[model samples]
Target: MAPKPPTAVTRPPISDSSLVYVPEDVVEGYQERIETGIDWTLIELGAQHHRRKAINREAIPTITFSDGLINKINRGYLKGFLDDTSCINLDQQWEQILPATLWDNEKFATDEGKILFNGINCLTDDLIKLIYKAVVTGNRDTLWSELKMAEVLRVNNEKITELDVGLLEFKKLVSLNLCGNYIMDIEPNFIPPTLRALELQANHISNINSFVESLPHHLIYIGLAKNLLTDESVDAFSRLPFNLTVLDLSDNDIYHLDPLLDALVRLPNLTSLYLVGNPCSVCATYARLILMVLPRLKWLDSRQVLPTDRSLEPYEAHPDDLRSSYFYFTVFRVMSAPQPPKPEKGATTAFHVELELPLLDVERRKFLLYRRYESLTEILAPPEEEEVEKAISTVLRPSTKALSTIKGIDVDEASSNASNVYDHLVTKSSRVINNFTTFESNKIQWAKVMNFQEPTVKIFCPDLFALRNTFRSVITVNLVYSIVYAKSGKTEKKSSHALKMPTEQRVVLASIKCTLRNPDWTQPSQHFHWDDSLGTDEAIHWGDRDLAVIQYTQAPVKVVKGKPEADPATSSRQLPPENLTCHFGFGIETIRAS
Candidate 1:
């Protein structure tokens, strides 16, 4: 409701502050004239006409609510306003169905604080027996006829813990306000099928797994505000009746918007909704996601929905640019990888990543954008021609310094059979993701003062983009990288001037997993920094100059540092740091299907 001062009712005997003031119904001339004597024939005709109209309204529900009928009623209402006449006493034509109150166009005000209701009426054992007897015996004068005959009931702010079985007796009940009670669970067969609206707000009720199935199919509105609701409570909403249109869950404990929206998308008729004061409402993409997930909504909270609400510019990469856009990636450099102290393993394969990034849809997905867009192929398309892979070097870049003498550098022998040991070991799923798999090379390196410069990598997954989660503002993707290490061996010195050749033995030091948090467009590209150490408590955060130190998890890694080696004569392990952050990109230079 708008926060305007209440309007005044214009009736002389009674006044309502909530109603807009209008002139009292009055007239002179022919309007006030009345026949001195009534003709029996005319009176009988008038009574018959009135009876026929009333019968038609109830018998033809569709026609009664048709656009023409509603428009006539609205014209009468508008005429009342135009003539400066009051509606305290409505015309006989409208008195039967419409309430005698202010016009909907007139603003009304509510008191401060959460909306509440005060209901004390309830059916007792005597009333139940009387109602049953009245139904069986066709009696009308009993007490049950006077009570429970009304269409609306507000039994709020009570100690009621569950839906009352006796509530099924109200055959004409249209709305039931059971808010501000202790309803922890919902049992079947209690709610009347005729009930159209229900209020379960401000209660101890939590999960609604059974509530969805128990709900009456005719119910169109529900209020579960100010409860202990969670993501689990709304997971079963796909089973809710399709006729439901309005729902209120304001001031609740719903923090996971992904699951909640995923469930709500199945409720096709749901339009007006309220989620104020809930933890999910505070998410950065809360409004955009809600509108995207439920575009049929005509009202959200107190405001009317708008066309602009569907725009996702505030949350994700400009999806409209996908046709012209490209998915690209670059391994700029490992910020501070230590050079292997072994003089032989000069340039070991830094990171070997054999990965499969398939567009997957799983239950309880942490990322909501994936569900909205469905697949990367849908959001992004292949260009008319494929772009060539840039001459990227995942290998170390050539040194800028000049070497006076070049020795018998056997680069091909060091690379040969480098992946023999670690190729057999595979990476399994992590706790958060289930569709991931990886393998690394066996060769390893221990950097003393090795610095990684920007290196180019062939963009493998071109049909990919960052996916955003409703709860977090950043878009992220997961990747696993291995730090290959060389196996220890004694350096054999060649006789005389003939220098000895370095042995080819390799081992996988460790394979680490990382999540790339895409930087916003307004901000400069963020760089990745090598982690000082490895631990479970490590975090992924931005550092100075947009560089972030990634402390990745090693849950499914192939090997740990202290694991036993095949040769006892080999030197002690000199494992390199586990993490490094650098410039990265994933433009679509090449496209592959999963």
Candidate 2:
């Protein structure tokens, strides 16, 4: 039961100061009435005597209280207080409140040295401020409810219009529980970087922009549920670092879904997005629309049913306007075969091609007889175009003597040989053309083609598929280029002429692989190996004339001094070994049969 309210009935009427002014006889009578017992006459007489005795006494009655006074007091408390030898007395019945160690000093024993300290009270602002400091500083690590602190209960759930509660230095504090407060606005300056999990629910926080903007890198989890937020607020969250994985903004005023697509596509790291309470339309059209875009999304709180072809039982009690809408969707996968890489305007062009051989979806022990001729024709068109035409003409002609000769030759062996030839041609052509095409367009035009027939088309059971994989995707297709320089309306191929090949030839095949040695030390008659060797250095000798020799080759070549001369003056100071040089050499040597 609640304690009775403070009133005259509960407490005695005498003032503490007036207690000392009471007469000695009246005090004795009061003490006698307390000790005497079992006399109805004496009890009646005592009650009457007190009323009349008070009138006879001074105008105001006085009651005195001292160490010996106050009957029925807790004896244990009084004995403990009186037994202490360090208790000091001062003027007007007061004592000094000091530590027991101070009793050792004689000077502090004087009445002037005593201090009367005040006790703590509930109605002070100081206590409330102390509670806020203890919580914000994280010194009080226990659950707030367990503290049973009076100030917390009174102030925690109230609305806070003013934020400046002298908490400036605690900006980095984390895991703040301001969930039950009445905070309407979160100004940008108030948000701190150290915050990780902020519980700001059940509050009147309307403008979340400033709060979201001020949050720094360390902040990871944010809960702004059941607020007055709209879809426009999504842009502010999207600009945040992609590291943010969990965001709960359910049950807010978000209408359109388009704003979420751009942010969702980029957040590949995000694992969960809770939109359960946000009242998204769960109709068939909306669910299908969401599925079409977010394929990676695994969780769907908004009921998105997979479409099934089987019919269901009809509803017996359908409403007048109730109806079902069926949605048809078609997802397409399409791409064009990549055209040849566009070559630079004047760079030599080399094209790359890959041949995908026909492999059975499942392996077969032998060729399936049910397979038609058209399927084979489709597989052979890339490489065996000429072979097919030759075979077709022979089949149509059917000359008696020619038929016998064709039967004698193994058709399968011939076809296998032809396929090998095609494979070699394509591989060699691509590599050779790629080498020549490395030069500028002022040089030569080069091109490549790739062809493939079924790996099964072999004379002997060779590992055709194994060979195909090694070179299948190992090339890049580029446009064929032939460098032609025009002078006086006449165009002449330069690289072909420089290569010393026939002008009419479309391609000049040259092996690029050789070994390297000391070219300067070798005689003109000796040939050293180099991986970049293109062709032989044609020597132009002027007969019977002292000629200066200028060495030229199609490979990357350089010449340095054989050894530095002991004297600088005699040393031949040569020009740098330039790739392009116009140094005059011996004139062309012409010899006529005489």
lDDT of 1 by residue, 1-594 (tens): 978864542222212211111234422321112111112233333333433443344443221112322233234322232222444322331343223322222234243211210012132223334434444544334434544565766555444555555666667778877665556677677777777888887766667776678788978998887676776777776777789999888756676667787888888999988875555553334555677668799887766876755663433312222211122333432433422221323434433323222221212122222223222122234333212211121112121111111344443343431323333223221222332222212212333223232223221211111111111122132223333334333443233332222222233333333333322222233343334364532224443343222222323334457985533213222232344322333223211111
lDDT minimum window of 10 residues, candidate 1: 395-404
lDDT on C-alpha atoms for all candidate structures: 0.42, 0.31
**TM-scores of the models, in the order given:** 0.33, 0.25
Candidate 2, superposed: residue stretches over 4 Å from native:
1-156, 165-168, 264-268, 281-594
What is the Cα-based TM-score of model 1?
A: 0.33
